[model samples]
Target: MSDVLQSAFNAFLEELKNSESLIRLTVSTLLLILVVAVSRFLLRRFIRRNIQSSEMRRRWLIQLRNILLIVLVLGLVVIWGHELRTFALSMVAIAVALVIATKELILCVSGALIKGGARSFNIGDRIQVKEFRGDVIDQNLLTTTILEVGPGRSMQQRSGRMVVLPNSLFASEAVINESYSQDFVLHTFSVPFLRQHEWRPAKQKLLELAQKHSEPYLEQAKRHFARLSYRTGLEQPVVEPRVTIQLQCAEELHLIVRLPTKEHDRNQTEQAILAELFADDDYLGDYLPRV
Candidate 1:
């Protein structure tokens, strides 16, 4: 056992001689001891001269000693910073390799980070990504839950289904945040009709109906949009009602109506306009035909 101990001690001495980091650390420790001794001697002399009360002198001594210790520790850290950094980087690389082993989980985490960094959407905000459109109900690192909101964009009512989408999709897909405007938005819907020669009168009447329905909040929308434009440095968008004629095919015409309406009342406002337009025989019977 004594021979074994001697051999072990000899091995340790050999290692200590060869290890440059250990040698530097030992020298740095001795320097730190000298620095501490000098600092404490000066601190006691300064405190003795400045402080009148014994308790105050004691407190000063303690505080100065603590400061000296902290400085020594920080100096030691700075002296060995390169090694610490290398060790830290090695640990990080191992962690990254472990994370990449689970591809889906890493993707999900990456996507969550992307979403957070982008501030794309939040709880209760309506968003659309690819075929998925819904109000964000809950979100976690792995998945986002949305209360499904449509058979299509034209229909804005809830479908009473919950969709759990893997956050990974956000990395690949474009996200449309519908509630970004918060208060009001320009809502558009297509009104299809058979190709007719005299489409002007129907267009005029439809515009009039839209103007009537949206007249109540048109000024407010204009103000909001103006502020939004100023704050965002974007061009102020048209807030008034407008209609554009589009040729769906050789035999079909689509009258696209766009109007600014309150975000929450978008569907209701659109439904009201369509209901009124269809209920009137003059508007539907003479000009428009259902596709």
Candidate 2:
């Protein structure tokens, strides 16, 4: 048994010395694997030390490490192609064809990966990509699902349609996440009426309604903005209800109320505002836009 082991060991050494391809393959594999392992370890340590409280950033870092490993492995295989030039060239040609055929798919997947890694937006967040505005309902490798929203009585209400947007669009288009850093979005609605000398009572009445309707949101927004300001170092905007009068036309005036509210509650809030306004005064109810 010892003699057999010795003979096997001798044969292994002889092969190691004579087989250039075997040596290259073994050394390259070990070295490349070590590099990958070290890189991952260092990256994880760095993330742990520097990145705090962001699960998305941690996920992104891990994904980037995996991608680095894949690219490194592929490049190493290509580098060791001298021993099997024909096979390597054939594989390369096939890869090129596949890339060409699935270029859009590749781009879409890449976009998804990038978007996910960046934590660009999450489910239930209101986002706009180009002209499409909606709450992101689902997201995967190829597409994002949204409940569509548009301008109407309530400027931010859902349009009762589902839009499946390809992830590829994220690569070329801009993304605006309304609830990215804050839980509430600033909402605006205008009540237009003819300008008259006796408009003070109506104007004061509208301002009271704006404050009453937005009271719940006002307190919540202040707490949210305080944290957001500290985190982002941005100047915090006042979270109280604001009523600004704008001249719409020579004969008309606009009372635009800006308030912070949850995007999901905007439709209901608009309806509530209208109901109260109509109940309080018959004149403005006739002129207000129909819900």
Per-model TM-score, in order, reads 0.64, 0.60
Candidate 2 versus truth, CA RMSD in Å, comes to 17.4
Tens-place lDDT per residue, model 2, 1-291, is 345445555655575568667866878878887888888888777878887878967786879788887878686767565545644454566667668878989989988987987788999898889888899999999999999888533466778999999999898888988776546767778877786533556567767887888786688778888888889899997778777889978998887877777767776776777688768555544456645
Worst 10 residues of 2 by lDDT: 1-10
Cα RMSD of predicted structure 1: 9.5
Q: In candidate 1, how many Å is residue 51 off? A: 40
Best by lDDT: 1
Return the lDDT, model 1, position 188. 88
Residue 22, model 2: lDDT of: 80
Segments of candidate 2 deviating more than 4 angstroms: 1-96, 151-154, 194-201, 247-253, 282-291
- Which residue pairs in candidate 1 collide? none
